[model samples]
Target: MLYWLMKYVLLGPVLRLLWPTRVTGTENIPENGGAIIASNHLAVADSFFMPLHVRRMVTFPAKQEYFTEKGVKGRLKKWFFSGLGQIPIDRSGGSAAQAALDTAIRVLRDGHLLGIYPEGTRSPDGRLYKGKTGVARVALEADVPVVPVAMIGTDKVNPIGSKMWWPRRLEIRFGAPLDFSRYDGLVGDRFVERSIADEIMYSLMELSGQEYVDIYAARAKELAAADAAGVRPAVPAQPSAPVAGDAARVPESKAS
Candidate 1:
């Protein structure tokens, strides 16, 4: 297959030699079975180096724009990512979220590795942002352990707006699998989902040794862009008291 050839034959040899990439805790990965590898997104290279070091082919859902672009350059990008076996996701709204979970469930059911960036997008700065609940949803739905992976120094390899790769020391550290089986029956609870996502992000913060930011990465980016545009960002509204019939009333993972 193209993935096998790329990992073992073509690109693998070249990458391992050129960049100072090191992967640890690979033994933590189950040899077989569906598991979610929740990693911190630092740079574009995080996608490439993470899979390059792992023996098993780790597949993740990528934004569809990468595959749908036109022209020669676009064609090459599409073919390369498709050949790498990544799923193309719409990333539009709720429908895309459901579709992603559906695809992820199928991938997990097929006993393949699923790589996910809980932060949703790469960090604008090096700090780790609050993880989206989608990752927790996938793990709970698939009934698999969530492994926290920290990608170190990848930002230096491919810094923001830099097209060329720099020969920098990088590492991929995988932590012990996080079991969220306790919240299986309560996945629908938004608070429980938030707790689970926060727990995963906490583990990533420890693993990656990056400063933790409570705000979501997307929000941070939006605020940064607004600042660049000389426009003030609106303040987020506070949450009201829990509704009478809310299931989240029951305390879970990190409700506080």
Candidate 2:
């Protein structure tokens, strides 16, 4: 298959020789069932390095643009990504979020590994950001375990806006699978979802040893852009205080 050829035959050897990756905690991956691989978003290479180290085929819900671009180069990109088994989800329209959630559930129901970045976007400054509740929703709906993964040094090798990857050592650390079975039948409760999301982020914070920012990464990037342009950006109000259950799940020290 294309995925095998690319990972094992074409790109795998090249990456192994150049980057020399070290991965740990792969045993945390469930062998016979669907599970969510929740990872910190550092660089675009995070996608490649994570999949290359894991034995199973990990499918991610990528943006639609990756599959719809035009021109020869675009076609090649489409082929490469498609061969890797990425599902495209449209990021527009009122129903876009629901569609992507459905796709994620379907992937899990079929007994496959689904990779997701709960932060929604890559960290702008190498710090972990607040996680979206979508990951919590999917985990609860699909009844699958969520494994927190940390990719270190990927950003240096493939910095944002860099076309070619530089040779560097890469380290991936996988934390134990988090079971949210206690929250069963509590899906759709916003408070419950927030608690779950915070717990996942807390686990990543401990595993990655990155400062946890209370705000979303996308908003942080916007603020940075505004500062660069010398424009005063309207500061959004802080998020509401977490519920009591959330406090227990995510310690105050880590979040601050």
Give the Cα lDDT of each candidate: 0.83, 0.87
lDDT of 2 by residue, 169-242 (tens): 88999999999888788788776788888888888988888877788888989988897898866334443322
- Model 1, 1-256: lDDT tens digits are 9888877887778888889777789999989999998999989888888988888889989999999999999999897887676889888988877987899988998999999999899999888887898887888888999888999999998998999999987888999988888776766777877777878887887888787777888998898888778896632333122122213444745343
- Residue ranges of candidate 2 with Cα displaced over 4 Å: 233-256
Best by lDDT: 2
Off by over 4 Å in 1: 233-256
TM-score list, all predictions:
0.89, 0.91
